[model samples]
Target: MFAVVLLAHGDVVRERKIAAHVMKGSVEIRSNHRELRARLREAGSVRDTAVEGIVERLDPLGPVCTGVIDGGVAFGVRVTVPYVILGPIPRETFETLDWPR
Candidate 1:
């Protein structure tokens, strides 16, 4: 459960209703969280721990995003029409991604 900032055209808005999932110890995905989790794990991260976080269902439409940890901050992206840029949290609170041991 976390907030996601969605960007479209030229607007940045935070979405608190959406879901989030820890894809690994470094990445998290939001929007269609469950399907993405299964898909992500199928792609690689097939560890015993599965995935961490909630799978909040969202209306399937357009515009989705993900992020990662870098230099103690979340810094990653999803290349699309407007090119979505993701987080660094608040420079204080950090997301503890769950990974299999």
Candidate 2:
């Protein structure tokens, strides 16, 4: 199973909505930062400080941030499997029950 960590600049409701949209194929996987921020703000107020903090924490983890916003609507989404802590593992490992390289 793949775990997806979705970070957004809004409340939990907004985050979940975006996650659902992403999962349902309604929202494109690669969305512009501006668009995302706008959508997030629709749910609630988004703080720049909070967005920056999340970005700083997730950037090292190889999470990709959309670059369509003016450094305001920054966030990340990380998909990984549970129980593995070494980093992103191979899909084949999970399928075959083999050790991840």
Candidate 3:
């Protein structure tokens, strides 16, 4: 599945807002042209399930809140396209990120 990562210069709320819009069918998550509404419903907390999973890896750095929207087709080729919102915190607060080494 494809992953959309939005890095904003604003606060956490902005990140959440973008995530919400992307998740709520506002922004197109993928070009596959499949409706992700059903997968999202089955995933329970989209934010917690997808976004938080990524955020957990960044916890050691600082406080970074996340939101996610699922996108993909079902059947045997089911994929969970994740829309990730990254909150910007103080540089000093984070010693390092889970970015590429």
Candidate 4:
């Protein structure tokens, strides 16, 4: 499983883990990769569009949202305080997280 960690500046607040395959499908959809979305759906990685809402609500800490996966970064809006790390991030990523101080 991978997870999404919510951050306020460098402080971690909330985190939610999800299935890696579901996360992959979500990243593709959120990134607007049309071909990959179709492929993921066909391959049964993503069942439907409802997964989008599920992933978006994973971190309801604030309004700001973004996705970072496979070292790729994309923001739904300009980066700012109270942002969400939409990761299906692996175990190694957990070790690198900026824990609350």
Candidate 5:
């Protein structure tokens, strides 16, 4: 999921270009043998052409405890949030419901 976000955010923009080249036209290989190689080479070199503001390192995140009842990834598009604890249980609702004779 994180990878999907990164791909959409111009992180792997060149990869999208490369894929287009590989699948140009309807079942057609638009590029000649040399040209296809060149396109691939260009795609591989996109990162080399850019320097500023690129993510230098993607340090792995998590196994950190999420503070909500379901704050992390779960099965099949579901998220698991952590349970929240409310301090000092309130008794006002119970008291109001009781009628005094």
Candidate 6:
């Protein structure tokens, strides 16, 4: 599980907790050299590709916690596009929610 947030003009506008199962595709060689070459050609090439996954669950991200670093990765469809966490996070006014690391 990881937290995904949307930031606009240095403020957290929206957030969500996403639980996903990542699926990675692979190519294998079998039999002779001709088959291996064909598979290799068909596989093409990729760089810094984001892994595909199915979202198992989604929950709201309640309040922001200051001083404590929540566990999450910058997620996006394209690797070329950048996502950033900006400015100061607002302190949680209420009791802490059970954060999933």
lDDT (CA) for every model shown? Answer: 0.31, 0.40, 0.42, 0.39, 0.31, 0.26
* Model 4 C-alpha lDDT per residue in residues 17-39, reported as the tens digit of each score: 22335334444344555664455
The backbone clash count of each candidate, in order, is 0, 0, 0, 0, 10, 0
Order the numbered candidates by lDDT, best leading: 3, 2, 4, 1, 5, 6
Q: Which digits, one per residue and each the tens of the lDDT, describe model 6 over residues 1-101?
A: 23443321111111121112321221112224356455444432221121111111221233222222333343211112222222233355123556578
Candidate 3 weakest ten by summed lDDT = 7-16
Which scores higher on TM-score, 1 or 5? 5
The TM-score of predicted model 6 comes to 0.17
- The sequence of per-residue lDDT tens digits that candidate 5 reaches over residues 11-92 is 1222223345333341223335455546645743563333211323212221111132333322211233222222222355
Q: Please provide, for model 2 over 1-101, each residue's C-alpha lDDT reduced to its tens digit, 9 standing for 90 to 100.
A: 33334333322223333554344432543445457556656634344444455556545454334221222221333232112122343565445653468
Alpha-carbon runs more than 4 Å astray in model 4: 1-51, 55-60, 71-101
Better of 2 and 6 by TM-score: 2
Segments of candidate 3 deviating more than 4 angstroms: 1-40, 44-47, 67-101
Looking at model 5, residue 75 earns an lDDT score of: 22
Q: TM-score for model 4? A: 0.20
Q: Any residue pairs clashing in model 2, and if so which?
A: none
lDDT of 1 by residue, 7-92 (tens): 22111112232223412322234445566556644643332111112111221222234443222212232222222232333433
Candidate 1: stretches off by over 4 Å: 1-29, 45-101
Best candidate according to lDDT: 3
RMSD of 4: 16.8
Q: What TM-score fits each model?
A: 0.19, 0.24, 0.30, 0.20, 0.26, 0.17
Native RMSD of candidate 3 (Å): 13.4
Cα displacement (angstroms), candidate 6, residue 63, comes to 27
Candidate 5 shows a clash count of: 10
Pick out the ten consecutive residues of candidate 5 with the lowest summed lDDT.
3-12
